[model samples]
Target: MLVHVRSDGVNAKYNEELATECLVWINQVTGGSVNTAGDMDNFYEVLKDGTLLCQLVNSIQSGIVKKVNNSKMAFKCMENINAFLEAARQLGVPAQETFQTVDLWERQNLNSVVICLQSLGRKAGNYGKPSIGPKEAEKNERVFSEEKLKAGQTIIGLQMGSNKGANQSGINFGNTRHM
Candidate 1:
């Protein structure tokens, strides 16, 4: 791959490595049909139609996509991508983690697509499915009794700062600009 100086440089360093991991994970989950996604262009070609993406999501949870369009029509392929994204969201992937249809279909910002797949992998792991990325982001929901809530109201929040030794004299900003 030729280096393009005027590109999104942030992910340029690790995008290839991360994309490779995503491709491996997708193949593992979807029965290994994808042959090669060694680079961004190849990755786009492999997933541009969205069939494999939908299949991987379906394998994670049956019928999440409802349907996967296999036609070559432009609309059909974009729909497939949309379907896959909806399914991924149903599987607990965050909305921000999914890429727009144009990103893959128009071959723009494919790195976002790679990130989406990586997020899907983590979400799949959370649901006890096969995953490829780091550990799933677990929710830590806390429950507080009424007493605890009342105690919290009495205590000053750290954001408000401590006012134990308050004074009337505060630094005035130019004496309030009196005429």
Candidate 2:
């Protein structure tokens, strides 16, 4: 019993209120450091980028193909559908069944995108937990590691020089004495 919001008549005041609330929540969760002053404006500018929407569409299309042709492939398709639905739910979009036909799923996905955009716009600030503190770099210790440079083994083709210029008469390279 998921309630679907119509995208055709989205309320501007509602969106603005949701966006402001989302910003406040984001500030609360992330300590107001995740986004710069104008980042939210930039986000609203690119909200309709359609990258994720296109990915969802492709997943649905592929799943539909698999469902019609091969049962094994269809299982993979179902997994894709389930993943999309789960992600949508996590983003506050309503439930959409994988059992539905591809056409229905496509329409539902489109609706889900609109819903997700609205929900995200409203709750973006509240999504993630604040960092406790800076994380320490991991140190790995290994026994019997391979030797990088063995003793008494000089790298070849390297030039060595003395500041006294006494060795300038001779072309001395590295530890090798060239006479």
Candidate 3:
């Protein structure tokens, strides 16, 4: 969860806070037996040779073994699930459908929650990588133009659409009959 964002100009400490919040939420939802400090060590141990889903299933099974069934735990689980989804959203991870499906307090829904967390984790891992910034894009464009020039080709940029067509400005096509 130690993400360096130098290339993207993101606040690494803030991202760490978000990651910690996500971990705490997962810990609470899983009754403190998954995604905790110790649990993550075990997770990494399994992750070296196994897939994410396998790691998730193993972690969830261990958590279930240690879970205490109670109304308070149930309530906290749901609250933490919501908080986790919110944190993931704030971190630019998409989990809307997964959240909607796994928000319930059914045991069968645990797999969906695991899947969502896996997806968020994967996206978070990639979040720190460099992107095509404006400067980089301009450089690429210049290089492409140079390549085209070297190949004796002229880049002809064309705009194919016009506003004078049947779909006029401010016209509502839905209001017309299809006769």
Give the top-scoring candidate (lDDT).
1
Give the C-alpha lDDT of model 2. 0.37
* 29-120: candidate 1 lDDT, tens digit per residue: 87776755568767877898989998998888878888789898989999999999888888877899888898788776777888788888
- Whichever of 1 and 3 has more TM-score, that candidate is 1
Q: Model 2 clash pairs?
A: 22-122, 25-125, 26-125, 26-126
Runs in model 3 deviating more than 4 A are 1-76, 101-104, 126-143, 146-179
Candidate 3 residues 1-179, lDDT tens each? 34222333222112333334445544543344444332323333322221222222224333312332223454555554454455556544564535442323332233334445545554443444221212211233434576667675453335645445575567675667768
Q: What is the lDDT of candidate 3?
A: 0.39
What candidate 1 gets wrong by more than 4 Å, as runs, is: 1-14, 142-179
The model with the greatest TM-score is: 1
Could you tell me how far off, in angstroms, the CA of residue 33 lies in candidate 1 after the best superposition?
A: 3.0
lDDT of each: 0.80, 0.37, 0.39
The local lDDT score (0 to 100) that residue 93 gets in candidate 2 is 44
TM-score of each: 0.72, 0.24, 0.31
